[model samples]
Target: MSTEHNDLTAANREAWDSKAKEYDAKPWQKKIASQVAEALNSHADWLGADWASASDQECHLLDYACGTGSVTRALSTHITHATGIDISSAMLSQYTSLLSSTHPSLVLKTSVADLCSPDPQPSISGPEFHNFDIAGVALGFHHFANPATCIANLASRLKKDGVLFIVDWLPNKIAPGEHIGHAHAHPDSHDHNHNHNHVKEEETEEWKKMKKTIKTNGFTEEDMRKIFEEAGFEEFGFVVLGEKFVLEMNGKKVEKTGFIAKGRKV
Candidate 1:
């Protein structure tokens, strides 16, 4: 990876690690998580036919950039096993804790690894990580330094005809001086007790630091389609969720529309 990309990976790892403990503590975070999960479940067709009809033991999911296993939790009932990979160890710890506590019987595991790295570790590139029936990243695309490379890496892990999907924000126009933070931005950091015309001046420093970890505001349908095709995937499909998510960031309420895009490995 380039030095710039490595720096971004480190920054994001630190950002997510710092927030892992209380990631979904806010009501809005929980609500968004639940809604995204439901949307994924409701549109199983985008996940491919094998995912729709396969027996539990026959399907395996690779939850890439899987912060606390939101995608895994969403599709656990349908797949026999889920392997999660993320750069943040703390986030993986949260995933482990949640899986053990709520889904004890489910076969879900996580590792601190970054497949986006040009030279992935043996443990991450091994057979164990390959041939997944489906690979998905929920709300993570915008944080990636290179979305096309990320998609190619994830695509390499799937078997022929396997599916790869991403659930993230669709491109939205931001009005003048309006700031729309990433979906996972912490609500607690914002002072909600007071009304303000702009984001708090004190929060600007922190936001600046956090913004380093975000690579883009959002992706368009055409962008997703081109990347998926470049990654050697076919049967592409994209769906915008029916519900919009309202995220409170440093006292600013930013409404976002989320979309899911998928393609089959060929």
Candidate 2:
């Protein structure tokens, strides 16, 4: 990685570490976890014996960017064991605490390592991830310092035919400017009122630079499909899950939408 890339990764790691406590306290985490679990569980059931009936020894999940183990906790009944990896120590600390109490059935392992690490992901508390059947990165890709490379590395970690599931934000606007801050649209409940397709004409130079230095709003469906395909995943599909989440910002309603994408490693 370039010096600049390394610096950004360090910054993101620190930010998430500090926010670990506040993040676990948020009610939104529970809601997001529930929706994510439902999607994974249903997909597992539909995938039949390949995913649904496999024994704990036969199938394991790698929950990439699994802060606080939210997705793993929600997926308790769907899969057998899981190994969650992240860059934040404090976040992993919180993840361990929750797992011991709220999700004992998960048979989970936690580690603190980013995609850039060269050694086998060493867990301060658990074990390295290997030969997993399902991999998920939930509400976490936008934090990646280099998403494409990260996806490819993650693909390498999975066994053949293993599935990957990703859930995250996909904002429809590009509010360009230095530190313009992330923008999320708010529509009526369960409504997808804004166009999520890229609008290049509306972007300014500041926005272009920002895309390199910081993760903007998030990845679009088409953007994600291309990335997954590049990472050697086949049969790509993306779908909006649940409903529009309306939040109040400065007394106005700001709506955020969520989407999930799944693919199988070829």
TM-score of each: 0.87, 0.75
What CA RMSD would candidate 1 show? 4.3
- Estimate, for each residue in 174-207, the C-alpha lDDT of model 1 and write its tens digit: 4332334543333322233544564644566556
Error of 1 at 121 (Å): 2.4
lDDT of 2 by residue, 208-251 (tens): 33334345455678778888999899978787866754443232
Candidate 1, residue 122: CA error in Å? 2.4
- What do the candidate models score in CA lDDT, each in turn? 0.79, 0.66
State how far residue 207 of model 2 sits from its true place (Å). 18
Please estimate how well model 1 matches the true structure, expressed as its whole-model Cα lDDT: 0.79
